[model samples]
Target: MTIDESALGFGSGARAVWASDPEKSRGRLHAEETSRTRSEFQRDRDRIIHTTAFRRLKHKTQVFVAHEGDHFRTRLTHTIEVAQIARALARALRIDEDLAEGVALVHDFGHTPFGHTGEDALDELLKDHGGFDHNAQSLRVVTQLERRYAAFDGLNLTWESLEGLVKHNGPLTDESGNGLDGPVPQPILDYCARQDLHIATFASLEAQVAAIADDIAYNTHDIDDGLRSGLLQLEMLEEVPFLCELLREVKDRYPELEQSRMIHEIMRRQITLMVEDVIAVAQAKLAHLKPRNADDIRSAGQAFARFSPDLQDADRSIKSFLYANLYRHPDVMRVREQAAGIVRDLFDAYVRDPSLMGGHWRTGVSGFDEAQICRRVADYLAGMTDNYAVKQHRTLFDRTPDLR
Candidate 1:
């Protein structure tokens, strides 16, 4: 059965507002007839939940190494927090909550083991083979890497969701030019188009919300972790003029705030402030336009724009502080170096000889070549927890016997 243009989500007006072509239908699933019916956004959410990438987040690092503390936030927990914040903002703004949730859940699904440290190592190692980027890798994973389904090669996510994964940076840069710092050139535009497979331009408003929420979650949570790790003092935040002022304002409003409660309250306040700013900016742009028809409602300038400059600058400051105070501390760097060595060594061993790989990897002989071997080795290293990677490293280099 063919879907009429009118019956679909986008109408004539939507087509005009969109910078690119509207998303095309990818054929309906036969199982939808018998299984409980879900909205398109809900299906996106469910698909992310069941994917191996999503599950692997459980073992991936958030800030500290995965084995540092059992209760510390893993990549999975961070994703959940970002999703919760994104869903709250989406519902408040009448956006598709499920779509926001889905984007938030899988945003970091491509993160390598040992968190950003491992990602950096992979980038250095694979510079010749198209430098490894988590965002680009994310698109590759959902589009081609995953092998769960017999019918499709990937999770077969919706175009909107995939776009969210790639274009989450908002109006930062076109991939060639440094974001906000460099002039937009033709070369930059061309590079942006080719940077990632799914995104050729800026993200939608909903995707931008997810991106901002990720910033909010990490900024607040990382500070919390730093305090817990005894690396950062709440008082030291006062050294930074803007952060000091913000903290002072927050404390003045809520005098009963404790260290434990302060993080949650500060995050809540920042999110509300940012959401209101986003809505105001969006509405200001659409204020002059009059809706011609039903299509006009969806076509308004609601999908453009990004978090205000003030917010972006503030977020950058927070990220810098976290990197200096926590992420790059000697304690953290030591573990990161150790993890990177493990990944590098493992990649070297497997890529040199695929026969060393056990289980399902051994069965495929002619089909398994160098590129395939690299991916399999990457898969093994990427799936490891911090302790597991260390143990594997010991087994390979220290002549420790493999119990498994």
Candidate 2:
């Protein structure tokens, strides 16, 4: 098969000057022959979809436990949503759609079971050794943990994909190599030593689109899920003025609409509004910045893809309301506490006896020191789905907390 350049969107004059050119990709950490039929970004997306870690997302929690309700969004569904929005944004911005979609698909691969609760538990357990960051774990997953390839342990994704995965949320360090937010995750720093991801600069415009897509997807879907879970009522949404206006519009348009349809309509409108806002903002920013190429985007010193100021304020308002009324609600917090316990218990159990972990995971772990053992245990636990973690907890301990 020969490379189909035109089919890869390169032939289309629509692609912007700043769009990532797969032909000029920085290349993968491990040298591999180029695909005859696919662009590097397309190959990256396909590799991500076939990973064991990607499949595990089906049973991982988003805002609700995977087993709680079939209707709730799991990590897989959320990733799909993010990918959809990211592709849409990429198309609108005339960037590399495949790279944006791939980044969105793999962004949450590092999340532990039970969402933030499990992450918190792992972070606390590893505080002494070096704290756990899901973002760092995500990089570790694609670069080091996965063992499917013949030559490399991880997926051996392209440099662009790896850069997007690690820095989708933005640069981790400043000019002085100091952490931008806090201490850069040890896993990230360690990986940078071997293969420099240029931790100080922004990722490609493709990655920025993926990052904002995540914000748009989660914000819209969480509210939809909250409504389904009865944790958030239509009336409660009025607390956020932006949402209140949306509610008013929905009611005024379809006064006779049923509850479920009304909720869906509101969600549709919310997603549309946010996505459009992002496109408009990004277009204006791109015009002002006039970036000549993908590298220019990285050095632009500000995010080119984001909500406008008014929408950003609205986004914050919606987030605050969700935090107060849904995330920290008595019922959700109770479940979070129970879920955190399961993670904590599992970590302690594995740390005490590495033999208790799967045979594949325990291989050569006996020679490792305490910190190494803890990290190994953390990695094993981090990969588990909510149901698997619960099952392991049941098998290991006599009593397990009821997540419900």
What are the lDDT scores of the predictions, listed in order? 0.64, 0.92
Off by over 4 Å in 1: 1-36, 170-198, 250-258, 286-305, 362-372, 399-404
- Point to the candidate with the largest TM-score: 2
Residue-wise C-alpha lDDT for candidate 1, range 42-69, written one tens digit per residue: 7778988998888878888888766566
lDDT of 2 by residue, 1-404 (tens): 12222323333557889999999999988899998999999999999999999999999999899778999999999999999999988887889999999999999999999998999999999999998999999998998898898998899999999999999989999999999999999999899898899999999999999999999999999999999999899999888888889899999999999999999999999999998788878777877789999999999999988888899999999889889988999999999999999999999999998999995898898689999999999999999999999999999999998798
In candidate 1 the C-alpha lDDT for residue 84 amounts to: 89
Worst 10 residues of 2 by lDDT: 1-10
C-alpha lDDT of residue 380 in model 1: 55
* Candidate 2: residue 31 Cα off by (Å): 0.6
With a 3 Å backbone cut-off (N, CA, C), the pairs that clash in candidate 1 are: none
